[model samples]
Target chain A: MDDPEYRAGIIDLLGALAVGELTAFQRLAADAELAPTRADQAALAGMAVAEFHHFEQIRDRLTELGVALDDAMTPFHEPYVAFHANTAPSNWLEGLVKAYVGDQIATDFYREIAATVDDDTRALVNDVLAEAGHADFVVDRVRAAIDEDPSVAGRLALWGRRLVGEALAQAQRVAADRDALTAIIVGAPGRPGMDLAELGQVLSRLTENHAQRMAKLGLSS
Target chain B: MDDPEYRAGIIDLLGALAVGELTAFQRLAADAELAPTRADQAALAGMAVAEFHHFEQIRDRLTELGVALDDAMTPFHEPYVAFHANTAPSNWLEGLVKAYVGDQIATDFYREIAATVDDDTRALVNDVLAEAGHADFVVDRVRAAIDEDPSVAGRLALWGRRLVGEALAQAQRVAADRDALTAIIVGAPGRPGMDLAELGQVLSRLTENHAQRMAKLGLSS
Candidate 1:
């Protein structure tokens, strides 16, 4: 807590997460427009609302820490915007897969990072990562779509792969730009951080979880 | 409560309100993109989420009464879609005014109808009508924009009028299509309903409030 570098790292982490949630809200709400039925639209809108609530929580936390909400969020804005622009879904099913696979991968990454943060920050991260209870809705719709037209599965599976690839690209860009954030993950003087082996394990775990999520959607990773 | 016609009217009212909230969520969320700043975007997104929450409440009420949620909402869908399509804001300021003026008008109409419903329905209607606390945000922004560029006011004022006009046109269409909803307002035998004079008063009040809202936003109605 006394370390200036650690405090800076925590701020960067919170900022990144806050912006992530905000963009997720925007993207999901936009995707809801592509929904085939009003019921599906409502479901996607519910998820968007949940993301906005999570964004509010992180915003409040940032405010409590004496950080300007906009200042904390601005640095990560480009990365998130670029990611969404590059991976914008062409249709509703692609949007569903992006919401499902993309969000879970981010959640898994944040959960891992949460392990390395202070108790208070860890709790906040975990709390926000808690699913909005719509995974089954996404899974159900995606699976039913595939069942009805097995041919679409190939294109969707490729979309899933593209989502993860773009997410990682944006994340790496953020990590490269924010040394304080990477320091928190990889270690600084007098700080506990993941060693190379442990970092490999984290990446492995993230990949494994991504594959499982793809499978859950009845798509190959 | 035992009058089948009255029951049908109540369902129609709730259904109309539910679909209204649902579309409001979609419209607000869509309009959030036109926001010029991240703060503005978040503000609009917050309002959208609030509308969705209200939608959920009306939805549950409809379900508890054993009405199918989709069926209750379907009849009003076309009118809502048409209203939004016709009045879609041209830019961020237009979007804000539409949100503030347009939503207030809808709220005012529902409140008037609320006065004629059963106590339970009245409570729910009032509960959802309670503002999401962002009126001040919209008021401040629209007023600020007008102050910065006085020329925009005439255009915005015209936009506000168009919104109200489009809203009235859709309301009439809904009334014509849903006899039960109209019967609730105009009254059926053995049921209390608004007399023509009372209906005129309701319209006057709606208009007055709309003007007040427009004035608050530095626009004319």
Candidate 2:
């Protein structure tokens, strides 16, 4: 039973997710200049396209749960928008790390939260997370860039750290601003969602993938 | 014969076209937000994806002509970037009009310039301009928006005008900077390319379609 408290948390998270996708779409598209060839540009465009697919899942789930998409999303826009405006990547490798580290973390959070919802919402979130594709493209691009210039490693690693710190800061804002949602997610298991332990496990998995990816790109995580 | 002047105009124009496709790709992905439903948003995304196809064509031509795609495009980035940076649409409808009106006029210019090239380049340009596969989608969306809210008509009409005017201003700059290429087009009949008069008529036809489309959307000159 999604009482107002829990519903608010889900809405808070979903709102953040929607805005994140919107911002990512803008970044990926703008970042097409980082691409070396027309084919590479199209590949980034494909990744940008995938973000919309994720957006559809989150937006539809919100609509079905009786939250107006815009209204639910309106509150979370400012902080997240400010975060992106400040941290806009200045180069190709920076952009790739932003996409790779940031999206994989967001996906982890969404998956953790999804396990706490009802069957329907779980299905929708699961479906969206299932399409979790394209990080490989980011990894490939970063690895190529790093291969060409080993010096890019240090800069990109630092950029990745900055993005994660900002993401966690804002994510905390999202979780704290809506206690009901946070409580529901934190107190899941028999109630309806994944408990905190399960959530951590999922996060661990996401982080491992990120670490491995960075190492593949010749960067120390 | 193929010379720097001939290439200067054509190259400037081609570079501008590549930028347009790149920008269009980014904008369509961003504009997917303007759609009301998942299907519509996905449709908008599909529309944006097609720009990459045209983008690849232009890049290939640039490569064949021994021009570095980025180098050919370097000079105009600030001006064109300033143009889009200033005119970003806040909603779905504005985004649609931009795609519809802005792209339509661009297609007109592409068609005209394609004709001014040699049979080979003209053939390639024709392939690029061939009916602008997204025109129908833009028209449908514009009409639907107007149908939903007639008030949208007046504003969109003005917006359409502004898009065209801004584009024309940029077009003049592209032309002035690439006079040699312009000469090739305007002087192609006697050179290795096609006829300029034929290009003028082709441009007229494209413009006719644009006007008809505007009227269909309840927009006007």
Top-lDDT structure, candidate number: 1
lDDT of 2 at A145: 76
Clashing pairs in model 2, backbone N/Cα/C closer than 3 A: A9-A181, A116-A193, B5-B180, B9-B181, B10-B181, B34-B92, B118-B193
* All candidates: CA RMSD (Å): 1.5, 5.9
Candidate 2's residue-wise lDDT over B1-221, tens digit each?
Answer: 25656667677767877777777777777777567754465567666767766877988898898888777666666567666776688888888888777777887777766656657777877787666566677778788878898898999888877777777677677667766666765664446644657767765786687788788767986
The TM-score measured for candidate 1 stands at 0.96
**What TM-score goes with each of the models?**
0.96, 0.68
Candidate 1 wrong stretches, greater than 4 Å: none
C-alpha lDDT of residue A203 in model 2 = 71
Locate the minimum summed-lDDT window of 10 residues in model 1 chain A.
A33-42
**Displacement of the residue B164 alpha carbon in candidate 1, Å:** 0.6
Q: What is the interface RMSD of candidate 2, in Å?
A: 5.2
Model 1 clashing residue pairs (backbone): none
Task: Give the CAPRI rating of model 1.
Answer: medium
